[model samples]
Target: MAHPLELAEPNVIDEELIRNCITTVEEISIAEDKKKEMKTETELHDIKAVSFSFQNILRIDNLNGLFSLVKLQLDNNIIEKIENIGHLVNLEWLDLSFNNIQNIQGLDTLTKLTDLSLFNNRIEELKNLKTLQNLNCLSVGNNLIRDVVHAITYLRPFRKLKMLNMAGNPCHKDPEYHMRIVAHLRDIVYVDYRLVDPEKVQQAREQYQEDLFEILEEEKKQAEDEKKAEDHQQWLDTLSEANLSGVDTLLKVMLDEDPEQGKLHHLSFWLEIIDEIQHEFKGMSKDFIDNTLNANKAKYAEKERFIDALRSSRQKSDGDSIALVGKFDLKKKKLMRQLEDLREDETVKKLRELQDLNTELNDDLLELGLRQMEADDQIVSDFERRYGDLVNAFVEAAQNGFFAKIRDLENAFHTRAVTMATDELEHFAAGQLEDVTDEAQIFLGDKDIVFASLNASHDAHLGIIDGLEDQIVTKERKTFNTLVAEARAESHTRDRKRITEIATVTARNNKEIVELIQSEQEGWNR
Candidate 1:
């Protein structure tokens, strides 16, 4: 008397609705079965696959009983996370493509999974997949993945991965991307839906092996650079804390005495102090320049090594074709066919175009570096000119009435000091002199240490300014590197696209050639 069960309508999926749909299917199966044993509720529990794609399902819940599930299709849905799928221990195929998922998770129990399609998702990394040892085919194309090398490293544990589709990801556009992936994932038979050419794989492995040492060296240099930066920062902090301690003691000794008595000190005594401070500052400037030049030299040497490695790799690829053929034991017929194809193909043409573009980009990058250097030089020149003007102004002002104004100011303070105790008067005079020394340090610090404590303070301020300028340069360099990376990625992407197009056209041409060869053989047989 009950109404016959039917498939659920395209509505929000819930636990009760899913159960009802399962029960309905079971009832239908029972009605269709002729044998009594086959018409039991046990057949309902054996359901292995479920398709809820485009079913307006907002959440994946209440499927605790479907333990026998092997396949689940939730593609083109509004699902945002991979949740509640752990109960499907036998799951083999999962299609969550065209969803909103960001992270790959909740599949630790599904060790039997072999095929997974997560294309067109928000996945930025390939982590949290360590337990899926049985996974073989993975499609994560059209995602936010960058740094193909790092992504490949994440996938290194999945040795069983034979087919990987990473096309349409930003990483797909990296230079030598195909070679890198093939070299890393040696067992992968298909990459981005294309058959892996064995010859290409071997070539990639050889090339990668040749450059591996250079890459490691570069990494070591980067680590060293980072450590150097940290050490420099620590040194700066210590210098700032310890700066002017000696100058402070000298100031206290000079200013705490009676003004008339302090005036009796020879000019040579102050001049000697000033000369010592100038020498110290000169030493610091020389050391700074030497360190900067050394760093630049190391950077230039690293770049030269990188360029040499690149040239060596290119030369090896170009000059050793015969040797490579012999080494790989290539068949004569296949080699001949490949040679013919290469002659007619646009791969070389595209490579030339890319090389030209790369040359132009390199020129631009060099120009940018030169411009940055020029800007830095200009800033230094401006700072020096401004500093010279400040010193000249201070000298001119001093020659006029700077000391007279200070003497008049000191006389007024002296009059007030007479009304106070001698110790209090000395303290007050010292405080007043400290203020004057601070102002004088701005310009005279370079020539003399009349305001030696103030000079240290000024140097600390300059150090902070220098640090800021360095940070600016570092930021600009990072921006330039990013721009260069993006340009190279774009060029590589274009090259790959052109190669794919040419390959498609060549396949058709090869088909025609095959048909003609077959026709000629048939005629000869006749």
Candidate 2:
């Protein structure tokens, strides 16, 4: 038999551990401000910075959920693999030094990482970190890099990189390690832990003239691309500031400008999202209608047939008209109660689903807006893509209609059924008051009429539902088109205003940049 402690999970990062860590951290923050009271980030979504550095952590697991983590410290652990940290899209600083990790593989989604330290690991090569374009400080010293020159080249794409450390590797002893690696990179301010000497940098560049020229050319291209990206981003910021970022506005602009681009790509993204919401709601609606029909149809048929048999049977009743009316009233209450359930329960459920769908639509669109820039190629790309899905999405969205109309129609059916059933009972009860006929036969006769009325109402409600599909579709299309047209008119004025504002701001910022550059150099000397 295994020991109790050994049988349990050994190196798991569980909720209890996380709660302790987060609460301790929050207490420290709370000391500064009473309102900064920490909530347990067991889900790991709210915490901005954390350290699991000295923990006896063997693996990086149980760290799922959308992490808003900005800085994480996991150094000095027995970790051998770099896994389960990709959801940290906002992660910028990470320290995994002094570990048994052999590779730098799992850091793709960390595009915003600016500072990373993976020193004193078993890392053989410095590849697969290209996604971290924003990286400026990298420390991979004491690693297993076999070729310093080849490894240095991997840092070429990261033009923003300014610090590097390969001090304790095998290639650190290479005769050309200092000169060649230094020459290959342009913007590096520090190597290992020391400031780069200007005189030594010049000598190294001269020593490796041919290689330095290629490196310099590559750096030049990188600069140009960076500038292009900057300008594009500035334009995006201006567009956002102009207050023209709603889905309706975005779709309308794409639809209008698509002809010039000769592609329908941007419009299609909008269409796909709308279509998804529409498809989901339509599916819910269909299932609800099917269940309602299947459940109530049997009830109607059975009750109608039973009442028919009861009316024709020779069962005797000596009760007078008052007793007969009482019996009819009892039947009336039961039938009304059934109708109440049908009206309230099913309709309320549908209404709740509608509310849920509205919430879902808002959340989906919000996420799409957030993730949009990653896929955006300036303006939804060239106009050569398919428009079929786009058109379908719009049609579907128009038809989905929040399910309010459907719910109303459903209530109408239940109300009508109840009204008809009760009226028939009342009419029969009145006949009893006027003439005390064979009470059993009369009551059965009235019940037979009630079931017949329900059966007819059920058929009519189904017919109304069948016709509802086209009615909502037509109404929603008209509503969507009218809104789009109004938005188009509003956009015209906003476009002219946006152009003027952008031009003014660009000119002012350019002047400011020139002044800031001179001041920056002056400030650096101080």
Candidate 3:
């Protein structure tokens, strides 16, 4: 079977279909003389990506014309020099590994390059990479680089880098290599050729930073929230009146003392006072009405009695008309005298006094009614003021500062998270490199060159063939483990969030019901 690299690489020299595909309008990547004799009208447009890696083994410099290219891969070839790669103004990725290049002066013009890998080459110095301010990923491994590390003056320009590999080089043998690399290249993710995945490291670091920021923000938010809550509670308590309980107690006392008021009875103690005054007035008025009716009745009774007496006198003096007349006249005189005495009785005098008292009580009852109306009005006004204060307190509690604090906390968390991610990536790079170096030293002690390994330490390294097989197996296992952990964490988080939401909703609903009941009770009492 062919080597994997050969099977994977594009065959640039054969096939008429491939030649036809390379039109002038389209992207055309051909070997040394493959497209030299082709005849066709190109119609390709929007050609932004192209790769010619390990092809055109005999071509020296034929990539100067592809100005529209953005990516070019020319690694694992016999290119002897680095030239004209800077002519492509839009180039972002350039890989020129496994070449005979010994210098690197022609890459200054590719200012747009963010990723550049020149591994397995004869280049000794990285002197021309100063202009690559936008460069993010760099690979300069498998080279005779003795003092290249010392020549790196600035690393601030490549602030966006997330991955870096510098294995298969002598720099890994430096005693303080890990420390120095971590101290300076802070954003690198991978350093040595191993399963040196830094995502977990970055995630842990970010999580820690996020937690720190969240704690600080939460503290600030909590403080503000507590202050606002306290203020709100104070206002609410004030509006409700710290004396509300006392007021309630007093109201209860009043209800107990004056049960008729609690019963909503129309006639209470005050009404009874009015009723007493009305009674007095009615008593006096009754005397006047009764006196008139009694006097008329008494006069009528006297007239009847006198008439009967006269008739009786006449009957006794039968046939003596003159005697009868004298007797009748004498009786009339007696009755007249009795009538005058009856009119001067004390009962009539007492009736006159009762009338006077009744009139005074009626006047007093009117005055009391007016006073009660005024008192009712004042009580209603007091109730309205207290209710308004309660509303104002609730409004104050819902101020904008509460949400602002939450937003600040969120922003601080994000910033700290990104910073921590960068730090962890740096650590991962150094750690992976050091671990691999140590593993090579331990397992391949007498070997001229240490190859691959199962783990990142020398003790984990097997024979070359066994190490490679173990690497494949371990990578698969590690990937599966990471997936499992992520899934479990996600499930736990979801469950917790769901439970909390349900509890919060239930609690809020219960609180609302309680408040409503209390309010209703207050209204009923008032």
Off by over 4 Å in 3: 1-46, 56-60, 148-157, 193-526
Give the alpha carbon lDDT tens digit for every residue of 1-526 in model 1.
2111113333566654554343222223444343333323444457666666666555677677778877777777667789998988988888898877899999888899999999988899998788888889999999999989888777866879999999999988898889998887858999999999999988888888856566557768988999999997776654333221122122233343324323212222344444554454445434433444444454345446544544454344334433432432333344435534553334334334433443443344344434433443443344334434433443343323323333343344333333232333344345533443443333333323333433343344334333433443444345445634653454356445534543454345445445544554565578
* lDDT tens readout by residue for model 3, 321-364: 33433444354354445433544333334333333433433344
TM-score of every candidate relative to the true structure: 0.36, 0.41, 0.31
Model 2 TM-score, 2 decimals: 0.41
lDDT minimum window of 10 residues, candidate 3:
453-462
* Poorest lDDT segment (10 consecutive residues) of candidate 1: 242-251
Model 1 lDDT, full chain set: 0.57
Q: Cα lDDT of all candidates, in order?
A: 0.57, 0.59, 0.48
Query: What C-alpha root-mean-square deviation, in Å, does candidate 2 show against the real structure?
Result: 35.3
Backbone atom clashes (below 3 Å) for every candidate: 1, 3, 6
Candidate 1 ranges with C-alpha deviation above 4 Å: 1-11, 15-44, 210-526
| Per-model root-mean-square deviation over C-alphas | 28.4, 35.3, 48.0
Give residue 442's lDDT in candidate 2 (0 to 100): 46
Structure candidate 1, residue pairs in collision = 274-449
